[model samples]
Target: MLLTDTHTHQYYETDPIKREELMQRCLDNGISRLFLPNVDSASIELVMSQVKVYPQYCFAMLGLHPCDVKENWQDELNTINAAIPQHKIYAIGEIGIDLYWDKTTLDNQVKAFKTQINWAKKLKLPIVIHCRDAFEEVYKVLLEEQDEDLRGIFHCFTGTLEQAQKVIELGFYLGIGGVVTYKNSGLDKIVQQIDLKHIVLETDSPYLTPVPYRGKKNESSYLLYVAEKVADLHQTSVENVAAITTENSKIVFGV
Candidate 1:
């Protein structure tokens, strides 16, 4: 089976010596596809450059991250828009409310999210949302903007069954990642109850590495561990889990 890591940040090549090696390892381990989500204006060039280096294996998503929202959020969105034509952005992504870190920027985060949502609607593209400790807040905005044309993935989804049902109702898929493998993670329970059709697999690599490698730096190669956990939760085979989740990803991102 060709495992696809629907979300990862292979672009963060801070360590040159390790970057190429890790990518090769991922390839050898069957982690063939990667979708890189852009944070903001400053890293667009870097992210796109990384995508260019491995065009066939890596895909890109363009959007202003919730944390990147600030006083000049509009200018940053403008910057992302200006460069969209140069590359094929699979989705408008990694965008949503993040109240866990800084509450002071809540207003700006909401504004930026809504603005990007509008852009996704106008462009006829799916979205990749990064919501952290702001479920109700994110749901509020999503409900207001959601329509038949709006579709996306709730990247790194860590919510209850009710929330999952709500997002599915809004025509969005849940992005299940490394967090589900954690011994105490509530996501395992959530996934066991929800159907696989509403889910997609991701690593959020260089971040949420699964168990066995938890607390260590994550890589796209570790996506298999996440998939294994999901398969176990659903009491299904890994190949079935991968096939269904990969199809769910293509449905949302139109990849």
Candidate 2:
């Protein structure tokens, strides 16, 4: 089964020696593509290094994460904007409003989110969103900015069935991860309700490790666990899940 991890931060591993080791492990496990999303200025070089080291297996996206927005958010955006013409970014992403950590930054977060969305539209690239405790805010922004040109993935989606359907209606894909394996997460119901075409598998590693590896540091190889769970929930085979989601990711990233 050829699987694609739509999201992972293996690049954040400062240890070069160990980073390559785990990345090779991903390749061995049939993870043909790994998409890395930029977190902030500090993470640019680190994440870009993954694409440099393994050009075939790794791809990147450029954008300022919502949590990283601050008083100096504009400066941060300027720095990333300058790098745009120089690098091949798959999408504008890991960007959206994150109100879970600090509600006070909502205004700045919204500004940053819209700014990046504009950049994506101008570049004709899809976006990869990172939303937390701000679905209403996210939906509002998406409604305003969405057009036939606007498309992307809603990474780490853990919303209700209604929200899942709404995202599909808006022409977006839902990124499912380890949270689906959690008991009582209630995401299985959402999964059953949504078609496999609108769903994609992700690890969000080194976070959201699936069961049997829960609470442990996640890796791209762990994406198989998520695929397995998704297959089980949809009453399908693992191979079928992998094939379909891989194609879905290709559509989202335009790879």
Q: Looking at model 1, which ten-residue stretch has the lowest summed lDDT?
A: 10-19
Off by over 4 Å in 2: none
Q: Model 2 — TM-score against the truth? A: 0.98
Q: Which candidate has the highest TM-score of all?
A: 2
Worst 10 residues of 2 by lDDT: 23-32
At residue 92, give the lDDT of candidate 2. 92
Q: How do the predictions measure up, each by TM-score? A: 0.96, 0.98
Residue 17 deviation, candidate 1, in Å? 4.8
Candidate 1 C-alpha lDDT tens digits along 1-255: 777888888788856668788889888877878999989988888778778778878899999999888888889999998888888988998899999889999988998899889888998999899999999999999888978778989999988899999999999889999989998988899999989998988999889989989989999999989889999998998989888988887777777
The runs of at least 3 residues in candidate 1 whose Cα sits more than 4 Å from the true structure, single-residue gaps closed, are 14-17
lDDT of 1 at 92: 90
Residue range 14-128, candidate 2, lDDT tens digits: 6878987888788787888999998888788988888998899999998899989988999999999898888999999789999899899898898899999999999999999
The number of the candidate with the highest lDDT is: 2
Q: Could you give the C-alpha RMSD of every candidate to the true structure, in order shown?
A: 1.3, 0.9
